[model samples]
Target: MTDRVAIVTGGSGGIGRAVSERLAADGISVLVTFSGGSQRADDVVTAITDAGGRAVAARADVAEPAEVNALLDVAEAEFGGVDVVVNTAGIMRLSPLAQLSLDDLDAMYRVNVRGTFVVSQAAVQRLRSGGALINFSSSVVKLALPTYSAYVAGKAAVDGITRILAQEVRGRDITVNAVAPGPTATPLFLDGKPTEVVEHLAAQAPLERLGEPKDIAEAVSFLAGPARWVNGQVVYVNGGIV
Candidate 1:
């Protein structure tokens, strides 16, 4: 995979940044795509370059098919063929099913489910032999949290897509999989949660701590690398929370 090109959406965020860095360090040319955080994305590119890894930042909303296709074209132009795609671009809204609004469901579906579909579809078009696709799910799917009904539903769709796509790409040697993280210490996790509540969550984990970004990144790296046999699965890196 030394000469492969990778596109990592939401590469500006905590988990995405870690995944991008890990892949770059593995000698892949990385295209870091961000929807809003341009500065953060550039910073991640700078860090990767400083560490003697190759990376560049691009802007795209994965929910848009045109934008996703354009991002793939850019990667191909800059680094030849696409080999891996790590999709971490997603939004979350938490509310009991009774209180959930249609707008919330729509917004989350656009970014989480539609985005994964668009990006993965585009990536498969450009993915080379032995290529890999890593999509993001969440541990909440297994845990069945009450407030995460909509968010988990979207991710559950991703899991279904991942499995089916694996079969679709069976002859191409392109593996499709999802990495589901559990209560990771990311901005998404910290958002809207009180300090006491966050602490309580850490205690609930079997590991007695929240998962780090690197924890999930490492799982992504393995699936993208030598563990090519691990396909059509959602590997959960949740500190045994479920």
Candidate 2:
């Protein structure tokens, strides 16, 4: 953990931006990877850099092994070594299990499931001892919400991978865990939902509000830094929703 470098995929998005910035605030160098929203990603880097933090932006498709490997190589060459890798790159298409298109499910699986696999495979090689790998899961798995079967199916797979990988890396000093976020105020969650629906979900939480990106980022910051003892766990940041 000499350099304390972190590679955050989908680093342009709301939660990703917060995580990158928070980790940088903690004195960790960040390698932000984005597939789109290049300008947004650059803005995050600039914010971190202006604050005297080290950060760089790169393009990588989390689903592609070569691209993911190249992205990690960028971190190694630029920041020395990777201490944390957070997979936040994912897409969701809402549809009932019966009406869901195979294409939508396929696309989500490619980016969400295979993407996690590709990145984790690289982490399996690149992450040093004492390093941590954080994967994103959804509280929907436990909520058992309808029209989420396909998305939940993919995330359910992530849950399995997180658990098995934790055990597989037994002696390695590496901690593998999944951060299951409840309905948060990210484009991924807010988009396509009506205000009433959003409000309904928000009120369901014990906290009586939606989670901010900073809230979720705080969780990742803890896991990536001081929460070394918390491994193979699904820490839900859903404000006591489930």
Clashes of 1: 0
Candidate 1 residue-wise lDDT, 116-193, digit = tens:
999999988888999999999988898877799999999999999999999998789989999999888999889999
Cα lDDT, all candidates: 0.92, 0.92
- Model 1, runs deviating above 4 Å: none
Which stretches of model 2 miss by more than 4 angstroms? none
Residue lDDT tens for model 2, 48-98: 999999999999999999999999899999988898999988999999998
Listed in order, each prediction's TM-score against the native is 0.97, 0.98
Q: What is the model-wide C-alpha lDDT for candidate 1?
A: 0.92
- Residue 173 accuracy (lDDT) in model 1: 90
Model 2 weakest 10-residue run by lDDT: 1-10
